[model samples]
Target: MKNYILFFAAIWMTVCFCSCDDGRIYEQKVDIARGGRTLKLTGRFSGLSNWADGYSVVVAGFNDKSEYAVITKSLPVNVADGSEIVMTLGGIGDEVTALKLCVVNRLRECVVDFHTIESEELAAVTDTIMINAGTLDVGMYSTIQSQVFDKKCTMCHGETGSASGNLFLTAGKSYDAMVNQPAHKNSDILLVKPGKAEESFLHLVLNRDGDTNMHHLDLFSEKEQLSLKLIDDWINDGAFLNNK
Candidate 1:
């Protein structure tokens, strides 16, 4: 019985050791098989240093949640000068079918710019892809700007002096001025809340619900109504400033 127990223990220990050692080798083999290459990103000449001290380029799997997961990040790239910046992504897995790019502020951890690229599109690219400055294709904030604020709200709240209720709905300034900020009339209600659109004063006024009796008759128009829905959707989708 003692010999039998000793033999089984020896077998178990050997199996454990082999399995642990093999796992690493298996992973390394897979990585080699998957292969990798460097991807270059070129962007327009914009003084990024005006916004943040430094920036990082992040890549992640092609999913809404994975977009912010930061699978890999580049070290700080020079953003101080208006000269063109080229960011190189090394060891990008061949299996990365679809991916998103996130340019983040190193200090605040906020994404200043974002974009999505498909594998097919990447394959077709011979040269570095040009990045749009301060734009995100899938972000809720950009949708709101193009659909809602630019179409309707800008009439009253566009430029600084023209903005009514001390609110500015210009492209770059709108997010900061409204997000988590108090309403002009009602200090208790926020103009836009990150995840709670129903609680937002903007939703209340547009829908003519709650204590706010003021409703824009223009909202009854089909275009304006669609804009209102887009705004509501934007708020529901975490009210993200840069990327979805």
Candidate 2:
């Protein structure tokens, strides 16, 4: 009986060593998209351990060269058993090719684990579950902006900004070009009102339709739509007048 008891204890320790907080492993992901030239990003994380406090969450993606790499920062999800974190990519510098999520123990050895990500999966994460507060720390921003600029805007305008004919969508230049352009001051007509994304040119292009049913694709999902609201609020909030 003593030998059997010792054997069971040994097995328990082995299992604990290999597993995360819950003695089980899970996968999570992040999603990113654009608002015209601005590299806007938001994503919901799933697969939370029953005890998820202080777990370091990182969103990683591929650079232009198609190499897997970290986005230069770590996103922190505070709370034990915490399964989700909503992040925004602020002031990102370049484009992205692929995405993934890294979950660190934040305990034990403080080691990290990774999972590949996809646009659709990310959309699903946000769609099915809410990302609590929906804000991004600077570390989280790296992944957010990278994904948004690369996945959404890069194909069209090259990076977040840098569009043709004096158009730049890069997050850094997005707000500026839109406000300064005299010829196209109201060209798209999306930034005038806050909280009302429907009136914005971004929606027109994104939804691929207008009062005339222009017949286009509504690329964003329901969750993405909510993210748009957050963005519009920021813009309507005087576009962070500190910059204006």
How many collisions between residues are there in candidate 2?
16
- lDDT of candidate 1 over 1-244, digit per residue (tens): 9999999999999999999999999998677455564556665433232221243445443323332333455524354434555566655554555555554334323242256777787666543444434322323465457555776678888754578778898888898988999999899999998779899988888887546877564455752354465567667767777532
Q: Model 1, poorest ten-residue lDDT window?
A: 46-55
Candidate 2 RMSD computed on C-alpha atoms after optimal superposition onto the true structure: 16.6
Per-residue lDDT, model 2, residue 138, is 26
Candidate whose TM-score is highest: 1
Candidate 2 per-residue lDDT, tens place, 49-131, comes to 21223434555444455333535335543432234444544323235433544433332121222445444444344222222
Worst 10 residues of 2 by lDDT: 29-38
Question: Candidate 2, after superposition: displacement of residue 82 in Å?
Answer: 24
Give the top-scoring candidate (lDDT): 1
Question: Number of clashes in every candidate structure?
Answer: 0, 16
Local accuracy by lDDT, each model = 0.60, 0.41
TM-score of 1: 0.42
